[model samples]
Target: MNKAILIGRLTRDIDLKYTQGGMAIGRFTLAINRKMTREKKQEAERNNQPTADFIGCIAFGKTAETLSNYVGKGNQIGIEGHIQTGSYENKEGQRVYTTDVIVDGFTFIDSKNKNGGDSEVQDESYDGFYPTDNDDIPF
Candidate 1:
């Protein structure tokens, strides 16, 4: 019952690291734009402001390595996970609250890019389906 779904763009490049036990861990930030009503959009336009929410996400194990390897800044992604919250004390004796979506699954929503940072996943070897045409897609 603690599920969270988020669709957003990567605010920055993904961070990939490993735990002492050799577990892969990836951390990234997503900038999700808030959907606004017409009134809200007009108000925001008048105010000249931005309407995006940046969220922190963490992935472990194979999921961690997969995300880090495939995407970088400006890539759009969709994630499904649960919210996790914790607090830690800072050097100034202040409590730092942290919230993150511990991702269980995700999808790459960006088109395949040939740039160096993001590698092109082989189509024949990929098990996931990538449609070659818009036909047969049931809307």
Candidate 2:
């Protein structure tokens, strides 16, 4: 199982682009914090900070457009995906390997609204994955 689940803040606004065949793609990085607790009081006092890990992710197709329109820097989100690794030659002819998550599912965990209501924004044509009132039970 190559699956990964992450909940983090976006480092910046998504960079959106289209492929030659007009498939939309959005790329972004997520900053996740790791909190450490020290056993010793003196040591804990000296190291009371949270470390962050930045992860690269990519969303394609209608998902990409939805992400681009709805998300921005510092927005909190939950992602479910799989890891992908690839290598490419740089301008200096040095090969670089990159590992990134290919997003398969995403959920808005934090509302952009200041009043704590759902974000009024909606993408009606988001690859048909969004739920409709008639589709299921309300919980």
Candidate 3:
């Protein structure tokens, strides 16, 4: 019942770290754009305002590693998870509230190769065949 899904670009690179117990955690910000209706668009233009929401997200374990290694700022991705809310006391003695999407799944939205592929699309076929650009059959 607490599920949420989002598709957006990374506001910045993912921050990956590990705990003393070696648990991996990653944090990132996503910039999600709101659909602009004609009226809203006009209002935004008049106000010179942005029409996007920045969301905080967190992932764990291999997911964290994957995101940290392969994702970067401006990279578009699809995310699915639940919203988590918490509060912590800061040094100022004020209670700081926090909300984040605890990411459960992520999808790569760009087809452009993260790893710049060779001149030829080099890949291994499902049948255990390595295909090269020179090959008459595509990989």
Candidate 4:
């Protein structure tokens, strides 16, 4: 039950790449604001600290391709996924640990227009999970 749901803006464009075996992988950062009381807000302001957390995330296969093609920096989106953590030795002989959300589903949350006016742009979403039988998918 390691599910996580997040709604935030993309810190930068999706980094799409492929493995040697031709599997697609996309990496992106999400900036999520922190909920705070007035006192906490004032304290944060005084400390000159940001009130948002930047989270690293990744998507695979068709989901990665779709995201890389359609989304960019500052676009808001909702994603449902699971947290993954790992560690490795770096070239400097230091142990580096990492955490990321492995996205299973995502949906665009912002309109195409930056002016916030009404537009005809429809929402786009993608889900990565599929049934074991794969009977429902046409392709």
The lDDT for every candidate, in the order shown, is 0.87, 0.86, 0.87, 0.88
Candidate 1 — what's its lDDT?
A: 0.87
lDDT (10s digit) by residue, model 4, range 22-96: 999999999998999989988998999888899999999999999998878888899999999999999999999
Model 2 agreement with the true structure over 59-78: per-residue lDDT tens digits: 99999999899888878999
lDDT for each residue of candidate 3 in 1-139, tens digit (9 for 90 to 100): 9998999999888999999999899999999988989899789979999888999999999999998888887788899999999999999999999999999999988433557542124453534465456667675
Segments of candidate 3 deviating more than 4 angstroms: 111-139
Model 4: residues with Cα > 4 Å off, grouped in runs = 112-139
Per-model TM-score, in order, reads 0.75, 0.73, 0.77, 0.78
The TM-score of candidate 3 is 0.77
Residue 97 lDDT in candidate 4 = 100
Q: Mind giving the per-residue lDDT tens digits that candidate 1 earns over 19-110?
A: 89999999999999889988897888789887778999999999989888888788889999999999999999999999999999999888
Question: Which candidate leads the pack in TM-score?
Answer: 4
User: What count of clashes does model 2 give?
Assistant: 0
How displaced is residue 15 in candidate 4, in Å?
0.5
Model 4 steric clash total: 0
**What lDDT score goes with residue 90 in model 2?**
100
Each candidate's number of clashing pairs is 0, 0, 0, 0
